[model samples]
Target chain A: MQKLTKEQQDYQNFVKQKRPKPPLLKNILMAFIVGGLICVVGQVIMNFYISRGMSPKEAGAPTSATMVFLGAFLTGLGVYDKIGKRAGAGSIVPITGFANSIVSPAMEFKREGYVFGVAAKMFVVAGPVIVYGMCSAVVIGLIYYILKL
Target chain B: MAGKKMGLQTIRFQNPPSIIATSSIVGPKEGQGPLKDYFDLILNDNMYKEKSWEKAERKILKEAVEMAIKNSNLPYSKIEYFIAGDLLNQIISAGFAARELGFPFFGIYGACSTAAEGLGLGAIIIDGGFADNLVVATSSHYCTAERQYRFPLELGNQSPPTAQWTVTGAGAAVISSRPQNPRITYVTTGKVIDMGETNPNDMGTAMAPAAVDTIVRHFNDTNRTPDDYDLIVTGDLASIGKDIAEELIKQKGFDVSNKYTDCGLMIFDPQQDVHAGGSGCACAAVVTFGYLYKEMMKGKYNRILLVATGALLSTTSTQQGETIPCIAHAVAIENL
Candidate 1:
């Protein structure tokens, strides 16, 4: 094989030493705008549930669930990922992102058979997160209640 | 490119054998100038300001590869090639990292399964004698990944019970001509599987089918029972995916009950506020490289089947109303 010339070697070294530059204004602004839009959607869901006269805590449950469901649904439809790509965290930072985490994998494995395939594996990705989140919330809630008493 | 020898050459159908070497670098979760701060800086103040998503991703990836190479004990000049990918359009993070490495490079995309895909391919190239040494690396950062694929952290957005925290780390591995370690023996590539789950809120459900399909295919192609290996590991299936994988394996008459594990489940303590196990390409990469490699080196386990699975979904595809297609790649590793 032919050896690299001096200039070629120098260029290669330069490339190796280069560090990636940070993002500019345009990208951050877009992230903010898209992220805001997602938040607005969340507010809409919260308002819709509250309008039905449900307690704040109760309303949160369904709203969160719906967001999760919507995220998963979009993941199933392969639409949520696109938004994630364009808006970046705008799609993934919300409750919907969590839903996508669980449902997308479950949907991927449905053909293996319902018990193991559909039901069992349905929350494969999100299981731990949900469990921990629930456990932490419970623990914190209990501590608060005890303190109040 | 070579003279053809007509004689019958002994072609063995045994599994591919390639040793694994790995490295991981994690930023502080909480502290002054925490790792997240660097990410925030890139997200909010970098030159690629509008492209903070890509910029932070590139930064994280660069750090990951550097750490991985340092851990491998192989000089940068000795790395024959680099194979990598990520969750971005054009995989700029991986691509930019490769440009810095200046090794022969190939870009890949498998959402969370990228690290496995790179390792699997690295094994193929090395075992086939195409190269003497190669590096397979992958990474994901919370700030960068979130900005590119989810929401901004400052928005106070609440994650649902189904959500998984994308791992905020990077992992890299060096595959080379070391004969005193586990070798890659077999690889089973999977077909895209989508079960028509329309809910985007849950990914475990979406990714479960892909994991099951790959595991089943690995068993089928090798005609081996689950008992054949000391451990069966999956990439980023977390708690939900692990349970589903176990159930699916049972239905096929192959029980991985005691031997199965998932990378997503191993990375963090559940009480640490990391929701679901872990997600992202680095989930498997770091665990396999940092945890598994150390265990193997210590002779705690001898034979392992690493089945890294990925959901091939992009934000654009989801927005365009496409179905979530997923795939898994299996690599068998055994101590020789």
Candidate 2:
């Protein structure tokens, strides 16, 4: 076997010296603040839906859908992305964030006529994931149901 | 202006190459294994028979180009020119690949945006009548890139949340004269922008400004509103950068509310360990080639503006405490 070159050995030493340390207190604090904000938004939405007399299950469904829709809309209107810029993972970690992933492209191509631009290519970014997610969820749900039976 | 009077008509191609080919040899995921183990995985394999990083990239590029050409069913000799580049110091990957391919080559570097730049230029060459058939290819390997721009993979280092996964891949496309396909009609070159970011670890922040700069230029150069193109796609400006880009575009007084999409945000499962989304040259290449191409071919999209952005930074520069400088290149593709 060929011996490692001096450059390779030096690189190995350099990497050992530069290994990243754990996140500092400031990093943790920032994550908490940002994460809390996103959760607060979700809670407010749920409360609003419940106050409107919807059942808890129904409220949860609509609230989640609404968040996704809003995220997607903002992503399209180019607003959600702005919030995400300032908030980082705070904005990206939520379910609504995924909706933005779906709609931004659709909104972008609205100029090419609705069928081709809006309807066809809008989901280019998020389509596969959604399909895969839904399929997997269904399969998992069925398996759980069968096991229960 | 030199070739403008030639009345060079822009022609489109039908059945363009889909971005199914990729060359991603090294990255964070692959770095976890032992150096000897990883080297064996890369070198002992059929893919890495070449002696050096440059040679491996060239081999991958050649294969990708050949695959694209074969998939397009165009004869090798019919390809009028080959335009390409990489993130390497002198872009030797593209140069070597071009040399081996034996076609006229035009090398360019726009960091991760080289893929779009090459495609845009290839489109222009064909449209301008300088050539009827052209090939555009770009590649980057995590192994070569790490030594050039960051730490060696042997060291177990953690990436910041803001860091993007540099896609270990290469992609190629054939632009030819087939009237039924999408045609590259317009291109807007962007100026380099620096938002004063010095952290090499967080590229999204660094690249966001560049993406914004180029998107703004595309709007200005074409005198078209956001409503003109079906989608405005930015390359490699993952989660954080995508957000910043949207904000910057809004600051320009145009509402891209419904039309902004980012390639970096698309390629990976964020929950499955890809933190900020996929990046590197392949981020835009694979998504544009694999996902977008198929949809477009199915008559899903008519007009699209692909604006790929990049941060031009090296490890040496970063270690020296130099600021991150970003650039973006835009290409307009229309299906007639």
Candidate 3:
């Protein structure tokens, strides 16, 4: 075996020095609480829509849309990014996160004007998600329809 | 002049360029990251009083370059070249910033690997005796990158949790023929690698193989093991990519398990909601120039292996269903 050089040996020594431990417990606690709260708000909104004489099936779209709207609104007001900065993946996976994604780009391009700048940039992040989502949806829908036949 | 080419893609410099100074400027979001204090400047606002995101991106590049020169204690006119690029369309950020810097500019585009690419080029230029002092800089603003590459932020669409966030920042380093510590000793240029990954949402996976290829090549050519370096860093591979690279490197018989890390992962805390972690040209740039550079200068790190990874896909290519092609450039920095 080749002898370890002074630099190589020194690296090993320095690496063993006390490094800041990962903030595991605090992060997990924050994610759990924030994620749970988001789900609760979603459930409450869904229930509110259903209580207004709308069937559960009919309320699904509006509930999701309302959450998305709130997400976008918060993102526009620069609140979601702040919460997201603190909440981690908990805030990112929610429907509001999706709204935040779209609105975040739109707000950034607001100076480029409404039609070209804002509208064009509106779907940059989520466009791929939607395009793939729609293509799969169409294929799956066709397959299901044919299966029923 | 190009340096002497050694094994596969290695470049053995005649006179290695020394990093005289480095400066990194990040947005407020990145300012709150774990390495916040390492940065030279962090704007509290994304706009930074600029009218447009593109303009703000250029401003960051300009400021970073100016800061690097100032920190180098070198006159701006003494620098011979400005080798830089950014994620904006046509890399306008670098181009516009170059106009302000008044240097002989060489506009490059290596996606997130622009920082390494610029450094590699600058090192070669200085080593080849082309010029004495050169500057390498790159920037990427989250908003500008978002609008150009993906969707506008205004749409309020949801991004997959696997999606990587573009770092809003700029990094600049002044490289001189004058002797100094933490010099760029060696460089390994990477070839484009694509394994048919089409999902743009999960970039970490798509770029991992490229990083693996470059790391393996660098190790093989240099005849050095992972034990030689204090740390090995990949540009924008994030968490998922870093894991894949570690596995792939193990398969290549190096076993760089403990020494390896990704700048994307290192920039922000895991609890900071950066999805798959950071991406963009500035991701690696800011981390290296801002954080790692200082640590190395303090003699905290004796040697570092930097492999800056870049996804070589454009908006039109991804839209056309072309699989994402990725590249990685490796540079060995050692303090002596």
DockQ for all models: 0.02, 0.01, 0.14
What would the TM-scores of all predictions be? 0.62, 0.61, 0.77
List candidate 2 segments past 4 Å from native: A1-149, B1-54
Model 2 lDDT vs. the true structure? 0.67
Off by more than 4 A, model 1: A1-149, B1-17, B29-56
Q: Per-residue lDDT for B16-71 in model 3, tens only? A: 78999999999999999999999999999999998888899999999999999999
Please give the fraction of native interface contacts (Cα pairs under 8 Å between A and B) kept by each candidate.
Answer: 0.00, 0.00, 0.24
On residues A4-74, what C-alpha lDDT tens digit does candidate 1 reach at each position? 55643542343222312324455566668877987788779989999999877888888887777777677
In angstroms, the error of model 2 at B15 is 18
Q: Which regions of candidate 3 fall more than 4 Å away from where they truly are?
A: A1-108, A118-149, B1-3
DockQ, candidate 1, comes to 0.02
lDDT per residue (tens digit) for residues B1-336 in model 1: 222211121112133445545666444431112122222112232222334445556766776677667766778888888888877668888999888878889898888888778877787677677887788878776656664555433322445444566765567777876665767766666677776533344466567767777777777766677889998998877776577668767877888999998887777667655565677777777677766777788899888888787777766777667656777777777787
Worst 10 residues of 2 chain A by lDDT: A11-20
